[model samples]
Each structure stands twice: as C-alpha cells, then as structure tokens.
Target: MSEDPDLFSAISSQNQTLSTISPERLTSDQATFELERLATLIRHYDRLYHDQDSPAISDGEYDALVLRNRLIEQNFPNLTRPDSPSKRIGTRATSRLPKIAHSIAMLSLDNGFSDKDVGDFLDRIRRFLRLGAQEPVALTVEPKIDGLSCSLRYEKGRLTQAVTRGDGIIGEDVTPNVRVINDIPETLAGSTWPEVVEIRGEVYMTKAAFSDLNQRQSEENGKLFANPRNAAAGSLRQLDPNITARRSLRFLAHGWGEISDFPADTQYGMMQAIKSYGLPVSDLLLCCHSLDEMLQHYHKIEAHRADMDFDIDGVVYKIDRLDWQSRLGFSARAPRFALAHKFPAEKAQTTLLDIDIQVGRTGVLTPVAKLEAVTVGGVVVTSATLHNADEIKRLAVRPGDRVLIQRAGDVIPQIVENLTPEVNREDWHFPSTCPVCHSLAKREEGESAWRCTGGLICPAQRVERLRHFVSRTAFDIEGLGLTHIESFFADKLIVTPADIFRLHKRRDTLINREGWAEVSVNNLLAAIENRRVISLDRFLYALGIRHIGVVTARDFARQYHEWDAFSKMIGQLKSMRNILLPSLIETEEKYRKRVAKELTGFVNIPNIGNKIIQSLIAFFSESHNQSVVDDLLLEIEVKSVHFQQQSSPLAGEVIVFTGSLETLSREEAKRQAETLGAKVAASVSRKTSFVVCGKAAGSKLSKAEALSIPVIDEMKWQKIVKNNGHISVKTE
Candidate 1:
C-alpha cells in the first residue's frame, strides 16, 4: 500500500552485488527478486518521467537498472517477469487525459552506449538479413533528441491528431495542444502525400526558450521546471492549449507510424520526402555506407550536442534500405534494423529545499521540488521533480535533505537520491484542495492522479476547452486568438461555441468598446460569417468529442456524406437504444445485440472501432449535447464531401514510373495517375500493375520483366493516360 522499505534495501543490495558478481553466478531466487525490484522501480520512474513530467532518477541510473535486469533475465530466462521493464516501450496513458489507440504501436529502439554495441547492432542486422560480407549495408544516422515522443496523424494531406507515445499501444490525445505548435504543419506541403500517415517525432524546447521559461516562472512566482524536456512535456500536455501555444516548442520528424503508402524506398530518401511535406526533419540526417561512417557521424553529433539549441541524447542509426529493414523485423521492444547510440548521462549533487504542488489545466496536481542551485552539464538546476505524493513518500524526501541531482542526457534534471537520509526532517504532504480553484482534489479509484471536481466552473478547464473549439483544425475563425477568446469568455460574451455565431447581435456594443472600432468589429463579424458554411468533418472535430479525431470525423463524413443524414442516423440510433433497452424487462445481452444490429452500418465502416461508435452513441444520447448540435446547425451549413467516382481503366491499379519521360514531367505524370484513381509506387514489386519504362529504363524495367509484370514504353504510357487507360498500340 505504501513505499516498501524492504524492496528498496533489496534493490540497493542487488545493485552492489550485480556490479561485482557475474550474472551466471547469481542464484535463481536472487535473479527473480532483482527482476521484480527492477520492474517496480522502472515502472515507478516511467510514470515519473513519461506521465508526470517529473523524474526521480538520472537516465544513467535508469539504464543501469535496465542493463542489470537484462543481464539477470538472460542468465535466468525462466525467472523473467511478464511485465518486465525490458519488454516495455513507455508508461501507460495518464488517467488525466483521453487515450487514443495507435493503429501501429510506436516501439522504442534498443540502446547502444558504446562503439562496440553499435558494431554489434550492425552485425546483428547483417546476420538477420542473411547479407554477404561483400554487400554494402547502408544506414541512415541522425541525432536522437531528448524530449517527449509524439505521433502526428494526417489524413488526406491534413493534420488530424497528435498523441504521446504512452506504453506504445495507446497514447494520450494531445491533438488540440499540438495544433498550436508552429513547427507542425496544419496541412501537408503538397497534395502528393499518402492518404493516411502518422509521422513519429520528438517535441522539444530549445535551451534558450527553456531558460526564458524558467526565468518567467521565477518572476511570476510559479513552480520552476527542472529542464527543457520537462518544460516541453508540461507545455504539450496542458489541457488549456493556449498556454502550450505560447511556449516555443519544436517538432523534428524521425520516422513514421501507420502509413497508407511510403514516399521513398530508403530511410534517407524518406526523411527528405517528409521534409518536403513541410515537417521539420533533422538536417544532419546522413546515409552511411559502412560502420566507420556511422561511428564518424555519431562522434560528430556528440561533439555538437552542447552547442545545439535543443538537447539530443545520442545518434540513431537505422538501415537505409526499406526492403532490408522489413527483412530484419523487430525485437520485443525495438526494430532489429535500428539502434539508439546514447551519450553518457550527466549528473551533479545538490540539496533539496522544498516541495510544491502545481495544478494543471486539467486539474491534475504535479509535485515540483525546489532545490539549492547546482550546475549539471551546462545548465543551472534550481529545482527538480518529486513526481507525485507516492514518490515523495517513496523517497521519504523532505526540506533540508542533501540530495544527488542529475541532468538526464543533459535535458531534465532529476533527484538521484537522498544523501542525508539519517538527518531527521518533517514529512511533506500533498494538499487536499486544488491550488487554483480551492476545489476538492480527489484521486479516483484505480488512478494515480488527483483531479479537481469543479468541472466547467473551474476557469482553467473552461478556457482550455473554449480554445480547443476554435483551434485551427476546428472552427478556425479569424480574429479569435487566445487573447480574444479569453477576453470574451471572461466578459461572459462567449460561454459556448454557439455564442461565437450569435455575436453579431452585440456588434454595436463591441464597436463602442475601447479596443474595438467599426472596422475591426465588422471584420470580426465577417470572419464569423465566413465560417457559417463549414465542412462536416471540421464541424464534428470542433465539437471536442472524446476519442473523435480529425481522421475519425472524416470517416464519419465520408460514410454519411451529409450532415442531416448523419444527425438523423445518430438520433435514430439513440431512439432505438432508449426503446429497446427499457431497463427491467429487457436482458442486457439482447438489448446490446438489438442496438448493435440497428447500428451495423456504422460499425461496418472501415477504421470505425467500438471506441468511436460508443463515443458517437454517447454524444447523441446526451440531450444537452444534442441541443448544442441542433443550435449550431441552425447557424451553419455543413457541406457534404464528394469523392471522384473513377471510371478510367487504370483506376485501383498501382503504377510505377521509371527513367525519363518525353511527354510529361514525373510530378505531372504521377498527379495524372492519382487523379485517375491509380496508386503510385516508387519501386517494382509483385503488387505493381504496370512499370512505365521510358528511354534508358534500367533496373526497374529488368525487375518488372523478371517478376512477369506488365512493362510499357513511354509512347504506350502516353496513349494510356491520353485515352483514360484505353490504350492502342501502333506498329513501330
């Protein structure tokens, strides 16, 4: 029920023994106990670092724990726990935020701390792929940033949702917060992107911004964050995203999650393509032909780490060839073709002065540690994070305790240990009331966080939700910036989204206000009017439904096509639920089956899972929400999305263009192909329908021939496009 002192003693004893004794010498009981201790310790730290933005240990210490656990697990394979830290990617989704199930899990990479480890990684890849020694193994190397991991999902070239890498399987939906980040594009650069793609990357804060933020926090008498990583994580996770918008957060795309189609055939090419699509990728990404080149790049990155604006813990090396990468597959925690070669963790000792609780926009209270100033790496550490009340209890930390601090990868400074544990000190307790609203702060059953029960009455939650409603991917009305929204909300001029549409009635009053003039007032009203005719997908997303992201909203729009039809269907389903399940008489199973049958059409839609279906049913079933939708509908026209119905013969075919074309540019040719409903592939594969070979066609043509795929000349390709795939051959 509390921090077990026995577990801590056992961990301390094992850590000492493991360093001196070989793993093979350890007994089975010792290995099992060590494994259990490591799992508990690692899971505790994972929650601190990932969920709470407060870490208690240094990265080096954590890595040491992991390495020790792995050694023991290897020695005693049968003693390994199912929930072992070695098998997990990150912590589970925080209870404070809504969760999103990733279509493809965002796995972490296996770490390589030394050059020998890197060489072993490369050797393992070669062995996995059954490559010959003479064959060149190309690898893409780039700096691995020390920040929060995020997944940005785009549908049809538009940014839809952004989520944290929570436990890999499910993540917290930070879409509204991410929309405010300037580095992330609202839409793809060109229309040639995949239909659906999830760009995986790090959301980081620059050292300068981190300094400025801490300075501002100090001046405002706010809780000072330990370092840039914590600042970035805290900023991105704010429920009131307007706060996140103010922070200087940057995103650098490293890889991808779920993708409909790949733009390139190699890792370097993929980075370039992703960069062209308006996502900021690392400019240092390089293609290496040999292990020596990879090591050279890694050392170069290490030398430049301190001078860079952002924090990078190490260099990441991944196989360049997509085909070879696919062949290599994955380990339980990471891809076999990739490895994160990490820099050593930087640390220093400091004194713990006090502990403070800061309430977030979502009402979750985070505990921050105020410490005596100490230098770690190049950054000055004035505070560290205790993480939670449980962590505080676990550490038994108090004011005046001399503690060891560490700048984990020179990013976030965290408490390593209490050096003066023998010194008697008063126990620190978490406050029972919300610091911001004085509302009762209660931790839910089976939840780690304490939340405010004030709901919309809490100013923080209200402003945050309002900001989300008018975000770029939502209603997106011009002139309604965060300042304006806050002003309007505070003045009681706008309480709900529908109030924005009804603001025309107050035009005269606004015009007479000190900050407002006739032109500005008219412009604001016009801007509101311009948004009167909106797309169905945007409308659905703007409603701020739980788990309903832009992609899901688009799915709903495409399925129903019309707002009236969608609304009608929802109403019908709600009515059926009410009628069929009239409590006492109907069995729950029968009621569920009846409701499911009535909603079979929606359930059958691709990618529409139980979560989305349940969210929709719940939203429509609520009378207040239905009234809000009805009111909003009265003011705006939700346009139905129309897709081109392709009748061309090339429709649904996968086409590849090779060599030089005389009649059309490659971009134009691909555009034309896509317009005709054909998918484009970069390389020749069994799935390729046709390989259009121009003059001097090379390996692709040969591969196509070998695969028995159709190979057409430039002249024939021109005829096919010109005649809408009704090709006619003429005698040469």
Candidate 2:
C-alpha cells in the first residue's frame, strides 16, 4: 500500500493474530480493529496487484489475507465493511481501455491451502447436498493458471468482443488486444455452438516468451515486467493491436459465462466442447471421482509446475455436473461448488541484516526484520515481520545471522526460522522506550505487544489518528491521504481533525508548500468542506476510539439516534466510572462490572460487550480525547441515522442468526433484518429478542433456549418475511 507498511504494517501482525482466534473469544473492539485493518490491507494489496500490475506479495501470501478476511467476515457478518473485498472481484479497470459489462458476472473461487481445508470443503459440499460421507462426488480438477482472467464473447460463432475481469461486473474491453493472441481463434471451428457465449479463461505469457520479451525491453530501455503474469496483462491491455501482436500472449479456456444454450451437462464435457469450438484446454486437467484423486492431481501438477511453459499457482476443483454447480450456487463472494487448492508459501534463506521498530496507530512497537535482498516467488524480499518480543526471543534472532523466511499470507512477510540462532553473538536489544517519542514502552501482562504510554502527545499516534479520520470508510474526504496528513502534521498545519477543516483558511500557506499548487490546495479544501455534514456512525468511527469501529459505531448510533443522546450516555458512563466515595467505590465497582445491567439503556444492547463498554468509557473519560471531540464537533454536523420500516415483527428487535442459512445467505438475512429495522447480532444473549435457526444450528441456539428467547426456524422466518412483506412486531 497506500499508507506503506511503515505506518500500518505494524498493526497488520496483530490482525493476523486476530484472524486465528475464534470470533467468540475476541472482544468486540478486537474484532472491529482486525476487520478494519484487514479491509484496509486487502484493498491496498489489491490495488497493487490489479491496478498497478506490481504485486508486492506472492499468490499464496495474498490468498492467505483474503482467506483470513473471509473467515473474519463469516464470524462478524454485521461488522463487515462497505468496502469489503467479498463484494467485488478486483480493482476497477483502467480508464485508458473501453469498458464492458459482463452478461454474467465473473466470480472468484474460495481457496484451500491445506488437506484439512480441502477435506472441510468436501464435507461442506456433502452437507449442502445432504449426501452421506461415503458418497463419491465427481470433480473436474485442473491447474489454476496464474494469469489475468479474460472473457471472450462470440456472436454467431465469431469472436465479437473480449473483456478483462475488472471488478467482476464491469471490465476493460480488450478485443483488439486479444485478437493478436495466436492461442485465441477468430472464429469457432465447428458450426454447432451457442449463438451468444462468453468463453472465460486466462491470458498468460509463457516462461520462454516472458524471458525473451524482458531481454528485448532491457536492450531497448523499455519498461520491464516483474513476471510472466504481469507481462501478459500489460501486453494484452495495450491500446494498439500492433503492440499486443509483438508480445507472445497465450490463452486457455476453462469455463463459459452467459451461454445461449448448454453444450454439455458435465464440467469435463463442457471443457471438451469449448476446446472443440477452437479454444485451447489444459492437457493436465483430469476428471476425478473422489477428493483423494482430486488432491493427488493437485500434487501431480505442483510437482511438475516448474516444467510448465506458463505459471500455475494452484489446482482448482469444481463439481463435475453443471446442475450440481447450479444447485450449490454462489456464496456471498465466490462459487460454493469450487475451491482452489493453493500451494504453500515459497521459502528462502537470507541473512538478517538488522531489526527495526515501527510504532502503530495504537502505539504498539512492532519489530520488522531487515534481510539481505532475496526473491520469494516473483516478489523481492528485503524485510519480514519479527511479530513481537516473544517471537524474536523465541527465535533468538540476531543481526548478521542467517534466517529462513517464508512469504507470509498476511501483510508482512515473516521469519520462520533463525538458521544461525545457535551462533555465538550478542542478543539484539529490544527497546523499552518509544523510538519516535522516547516515551516508556511497557509490555502489559499476558500481551505480546509492547506499547508506548505516550498517548495523544506522541506525534506518530496523532498523525495516524488523523489519517484514519480521513480514511476511505470514515469521513472519506477526497484528495486528502496519508502523505498529505503526514506532511501537514509535521509542519503543524493540520495537527487535528479540526485543523483539516480549517485548511481552506490556510490556502495561501498551503500553496507555498512544496508539491502543492493553488489548484490542489483548493481541491483539498473543497473535499474537506464536502464532509461538513457526515452520518453519525461515520463521525463516531472517525474519532478513533479504541473499540468503536464502523459496525460498533453504527450499533451505538442505532441505540442512540443523535449525537446529543450518545453524549448523554457517555456522561452517565463517566459518572458510573468515576464514583470515588471510599465505601461506595467497592460496591459500585462490582455492580458496574455487569455488562447486561443498564448503567444507561445503551449498555444493554445485544452484541454490545464489556470491552466495548470499557473502550467507550475509557475514550470519552479522557480529557484530551473529549477536548478533541469538542473541537471536531464545532467543525461538522453529525446526521442522525434513518430507519425505513418499523411495523415488522423483527423491527428494532435484536435477532441472532445461527448455523448455515440456505434459503437466505448470511448477508441477505442481515440486509432483510436491517431493512425491517431489526439488529442482527452475532451471538445470543438475554437482550436478544429472538434467534433465527438454520441447518447445523450451534451453541447460540442452546443459549437462546436457556435464556427463554423466541427461536424462529428458517421456514418460519421466510414465511413471516414473505407474508405481505412483513409481520406484526411480537415476542411470542
């Protein structure tokens, strides 16, 4: 990314840790932060991979982040962001190319890195079909070619258009560029084909072709590609067909989209039909009868992956019958019937040069290991995450020692093993003071992070908070970014959020600054002014409170419609926390520990946990934080949230959904509940009005029964929703 790892990478390792933890074990604040951090990092990496055609991380490393994000969203559905990666395929297509909207959207496949993940995938498929464990499902196993996804539209057996898989729905039209590729035919070989069909496949460059092209570019002083995949993508998106013709780009048909008629019932048969129609198909593809055979094929392809002319990242397995795929259907993000079994991260050995500490938004000091420049997969590696002091100590890594590093799935690469750990040398010293602010950095009990106690006074923390305030999901002020925030903060021109709004007044001063012109300064001011009126939830989230992320902020906003009401509850919470009479303090402390008890009615909201309460209290209770909020409030208006419906039975009720929802996807259920003015919570509690049960209903079901909360089955929920679009509000 955008912010670079130096600013946000420190927070990334914690995100990985959070990803591994069960959602139930995570505090509301922790989940919120992890989700927010993951969303940011994923978007950043996606832009790097899609928009720039320069991937900083390997495919395995990238897939790992997406998988973690998927898991986190699965657990905390309500907390999912508007900018969630699950909502789209890739970054937006470049403006240079003409755009095309696919007749049927191009979707991604869910990935599996291990045998257990693949086994679980099979189990889920069997569970969905209500098949016995012994059932042998036919699957089409093929190499997942590491290339740009392309869709070629054929009309009357002739190639009419070609499109890139840009953000799934819309794509860049690369018809002219694709026509230059020798592997892609101008017309179908056979007359018997659908009048209108979109053949989907991968656009790739062979290893030999890529090497020759790079050598030619090197001699010509032209832009060199990082790898074959990038070379293929860059070549295929060229505006001029002649430029594309000069590059040896190749194609392989895997599937079809928007077909006028079905040519075959099975995926294997469909591939054969596509190949018969003049498109090339992979010879390595095999029709497997069971999961074991499918896995064996995956290893078979991986073992000889180096021998392949083009790059293949993984093996993709899809249900054989097209009818089975249709029945299995699509999940919120990807096709449930398919999964890509990815290769593990590539490993390499390098000497640890030095350990550098970077402070995060929350003041946690994260150690990054500097390494002698090395290549893992296609990306160059110079640094890897040391994670925390405990990890560094566990590895006993010292400068100049050789370490085995693995390409990480998360944001930062990680040191897997210190190869020279036993070598006699002085141990690398872990700093006890903040590197930037020189404040005391203390490691809390039972915590991995060593945090600086400098609080708001720390320049690093202040800059980061300001950066978050203008983040895409927050105030979302256009034209203002991390670099601008850093520059303005360093110059003391924008020390706070209030200062950002006042930038218009500093137009002359800003115009005089380096890299800023009068037009740019004016544009920045215009963007800031546009955000003068923001939604209550966005404004609350922008405050950078410990636990109050977008979802939690929305929860609090729904609990109290206006900022005035929210502030009143904050005052009440402060009062409860500040009771100092010696005898009453002991009694009050024990009473205040109850999360379900209404200190203010806001505390009793379902899914609102004790940590959330503590964070809100701790945030507003601080004089500096309150002062900042007061200053920010003076510069903007916080708009109240609106609910469209109020008469539905679920209206304003906290409903908990458990297990696998077949009739309604988890996202669909939450959308309908919210549309009916209901709150969808992740867990069951005394405050939960009802629990909607689906197949394989879990502990939440038992908890709801124990609390005597109303339990509505999937059919009941669907019936209630289908009846005149709503049902009367009721508990019984």
Candidate 3:
C-alpha cells in the first residue's frame, strides 16, 4: 500500500521477471509487483467469489488472477490499481435483500483459454472493424451460464424489475425473488416488445436442482451449497420471497440491458427478439460463422457440459451485428462485442494439505494451498493459489505434497504440479512476520510479495478499508454493513470513511450500542444520511485510490467536474510533481516519462492512463491521505459531474458505410456514425474520414477512391445528419 514514487526501472535491469509462470510475458519491475500482487489476490477472490458464495481459487486460478490484472494493466499503463481486480463488476449486494441501481452497467466477460483464444477472438474483430482477412465475422454461439447474473426489467410489456449483478453498479432487489421463476416471464409474450427492456440473463441451478437443494440443505441442518452456482446464488438472494419459491430457480436469456427501442437489428436479431418474448433463451443459441464455426460451437458446448442441467462455464461469443456492437465499443470493463470462450483447466491429483497465510484487506500476505478434499470439476477441492513467496519457491511445496491441480470455472483452481517434488519433505518456511500484524513483512527487490508494514495499524488494513467504504460499489451506505463495520470498528464506534458520516453524533451512542436498536439506530442514521449526497463518481470511488477503479473513478469524475475541479486536478498534479523534484532528482526516469507526458497532455478522460496518473499522483501525496480526504469532505456532499458533453461536427470523423441503401439503415447508417463523433469504419483506411456511398457502390467505393477518402452519396450522408452533425463536405 505504498510504492508511490521511484516508479521502479531496476530489478537488476530487467530480462527475467515475467511470471504467472506457465504463461510469462509481463516485462519489468519484477513483473510489476506481479501486477500489484494479482490485484491484491483478485480482490481477495472477488470477496470469496462474488460476495461469499464461497470460492477460494480454481476456475483456472480465477482466470490467472484476471489474466494477471489484465497484463499489468496492458503493459504498465501507469502500474494500474486503485483497488483494481480489473475494474470489478460482479460482487456486491451485501444482502439482507433490497438494493437495485443498475440502469445498465452489468458487465463481465473477456476470456478465451484457447483455440488460440478463438483465433484471437477473430483477429480482434478484424482489427477493430477495418476488416480484411476475408472478412466474415457473424458469431452468436452461447452456453457460458453457470448462473447468477439476473437483470429482467421490461415495462409496458410488464415484469418491471429484477436486478442482481450487484457490483456492476448495484443490484439485489430480486423483484420479489424473480417472481417464482417458472423460467421468468410474467409478460412480453405477444406484444411486439420494446416499450422498454433490460433482460440480461443467467440465474441458474440444476445439477438435479443442486441435488435437490443439497438434499433439502441436508435434511434442514441448512447451510449446504458449494455449486450449481452456489445453489443459484443462494436461491436468488432470498431474504424470503417464500424462500425463493422453494428454490427451483432457473432462467436463460443471455443479453440486453437498458433498451427502449432496439427490438431487432441484430445480435441475432436481438436474440430472436429475446426469443419471441417468452423469456428463457439459449437452446444452445448458434448462428456462428467461420473460425471453424466458432471452434465447432465451442466444442459442442464443451461436449454438452456434462449432459447439461444448467452449469456451463464457457462458449459465449456474441457479435452478430447490432451495428457491430455499436461499432465495437467498450473495453475498460468489457464487451468489445463479447467473447468468453473459456473451458480448459480441469486436471486433478490433490493432497497438499497445509499452507495457509491469508491476511489481505491490503496487508497482502496471500498463500492458501490447503487441499486434500480433492474433486476439481465436480467442485470440491479445498483450496489452491499459492501465488507468492515466489510461488512457494517455485513449488518446492511441502506439507505432505502431492499436488498437480488445475481446474476451471469452479472459482479458478491452480497448482499445476509438485506431486511430491522429490519427497525429501522438510524445507517450507515463508512467514517472516505479519501473519496479521507482527508487522514488518517486507519483501522488495524483484518483489513476489510479502507486504504489510502495518499501515494504519493493520487490523487487516483497518477492517478492510472500512469494509471498502461501505461497499456495493463504494459509499452505498444503506444500513452500513460488514457486521456493522466490525461492530463499529470494535466499539471505538467507527473510525474512518468519516466515521460513517459521524454516526449522527453517536445518536444516543448508537442507541446504547449492543446490536443497537431504536429502529436500528434510526436506520443506520438514515443510511448515513442517504449517503450524504455522494456521486462525484461515488466520491472518487469512496476514496480508496491506488490505480483507482470504478473505471478510474469515472475517468476522474468525467475529467474534474468538481470537488473543486477534482481537488484541483490532484492539486495540479501534485504541484507539478513538486516543482520538478530537486532538479529532476537525477533524471528520475526522465521525470517518470515526463509525468506520463503530462498525463497525456491534460488528461481528456478515457481511463486516465499512465497508471491512473500514478494513482492520482500517489493518492494526493498522502498527508494522511489528505486527512482522510479532508475528513471525507466534512461528512459528504461531493456531487458535481454532469457533462453529457456531446458537441459533434462528427467530432473527429473516420466513417466508411459503402453500398448501402437510400435513406439511413445500414443500421441507421452506423447509428448516424456513432451519433456524430464519427468512426464507423469497417474498411477504407487512410484513416478514412469519409466514404458513404449507396447504390451498388463496391470495393469500399474503390477504397475510398484509392485513399483520397471523402466520398459521401446517400444524399451526401443525409446532408450531414440533416445539418446537425455539421456540414462542409464537397465530394459527391
């Protein structure tokens, strides 16, 4: 939780660090602290697999810790972090039931395990649409499921809400436990749909209904689960909707979120119009087209994923047009026209039986191993990832070794060998401090992790950053949880996140404490004064910087829309790196690439790269984290970003269109060239700033007339979006 300055360039001057080991390519600074220690061990296994359905590594070691925190934030993009587990998505709803907020950010998908990761997902959608290598594309595929995503919504067609993808921007109002599931429908059947939509999918549970709900929770001793996607997310988050109408939960659909119109125009005509509106989709969906029919429908849905009864783990694909997924948009979080693929990690062996460690909430440590219970694909394996102390000295693993492992989808398992590594059995060690505050745990130099200098007196990093500043994507206070933040931080009655908004000045000392009452301390002080107004991008992701998340705190609250211009742009990049550090402290790596080229010359927001501007200049250069963000800005009120800034004049054009038709419809001419901030490209290069053409045009209108570009035609691109996208185009 430190490493701010000296943005390292030494590790014995490179040439060997690249690890994840089997797969190794990250370049330097000891593999960027193994991508910030696999983003603090995949955010503590995405809070034990999406908020405690209990998973401690496996689905290919949580996809190799989100592909090594997405290849060290794609090759050192400013050592990315700010609580990153690759910009989290699924895991929130700290449940007691009701919570909803997602008018569309339920994302997560971007895997591919092999078949050349599906021929590099069709050569990255033909190089982001400038298509070529015999341009075919198409897609659709399906399968992926392994449940609990949800969504629903609809509107004039009925069934109004449903939620649960939680951390993808709130969720958990399981619309009365998805109204007794009967495969979800309550309406939309024959009403030409689209009066409003939403739809998304998965909810699942079926290996014989998770073995008859774990044989009725093992004859009512209750708590059983561990699979069928954690018994369909603990029976669709039940705070009792008739115990999720007796847990027979199921659903399918696949895609969609926040609609209003799009009844068709493609992702296979909107999942055949969301499968003609009766709900449930994926009868193994299909459509595909070349890269060997999407690897023969992902090996026929991984050879019928064990004779299917819900639980799939990989196939997905998507990209069956929809204006080429709005010109292949989105990447910081997912959906560059979808991909998934997965399935390949199911080996077995077992026995290790010991190694523990744990300690994360940012004190680092990790380790884990355990083992012996052994099952793998049928989900039983007791534990896996040992990712540090340099992978236990590259697996000289001890405690009765016998390893092997590997695994898929069941929460990313791993290990890959050490089957009694030459049975000598005695050298194991590792500890050297802070296994929970013995502190001074160090590690450094070519770091493979050992952290915990006990910052803020590590009671596990102050009760996990005050349970991630009241988590559900930060500052979502509501009934303040994580066991009332560790019973109000062990009776000191709350410590930070501005003392839970100064618990109404200890309203009668949390109503005379002890599981407090008086209407749960006035509903946790009206959910901490309904989050005292929040929103400058969840108050800069509830101030827990370090490679910042929530998409770089909405790209620095949409580029400084307030908190006094985002703390005056991190106090003018820390007073221009403290007025050039003592004469550029002997070429401090050329002033850290000249302060990431002065944050790409005035950071125009797009995941504010350069390692999130060196984690917002190392978190406002810490005067006690700027006095806990100025004591959480004197108990909250941040709210100030509203730039729906969409100027136009085809804001930096690059279109292409080709042999289209009369008026619009090449999907509204590429959604009117992406609502006029153009770039509809699918060919015609020379950074093509034009080339519309309608009547039998062809060869991208002779490659936009051999790259001269500007061509137009469909009535001069509908008179440049009827004069709104601005005029001044002469070539007819």
Per-model TM-score on C-alpha atoms = 0.49, 0.83, 0.28
Highest TM-score: which candidate?
2
Model 1 Cα shift for residue 507 (angstroms): 73
lDDT tens per residue, model 2, 189-216: 8888999989999999999999999999
Give the alpha carbon lDDT tens digit for every residue of 289-358 in model 3: 7888889878978987888777787888888888878767765577778888888877889788788776
lDDT of each: 0.76, 0.80, 0.72
Show model 1 residue runs off by greater than 4 Å.
Answer: 1-25, 345-732
Ranking by TM-score: 2, 1, 3
In terms of lDDT, the best-performing candidate is 2
User: What RMSD does each model have against the real structure?
Assistant: 19.7, 5.1, 26.4
The weakest ten consecutive residues by lDDT in model 3 span 6-15
State the lDDT at 203 in candidate 1. Answer: 97
Q: What is the lDDT of candidate 1?
A: 0.76
List the candidate 3 regions with Cα displacement exceeding 4 Å.
Answer: 1-111, 114-350, 361-367, 370-383, 386-404, 407-455, 459-626, 630-725, 728-732
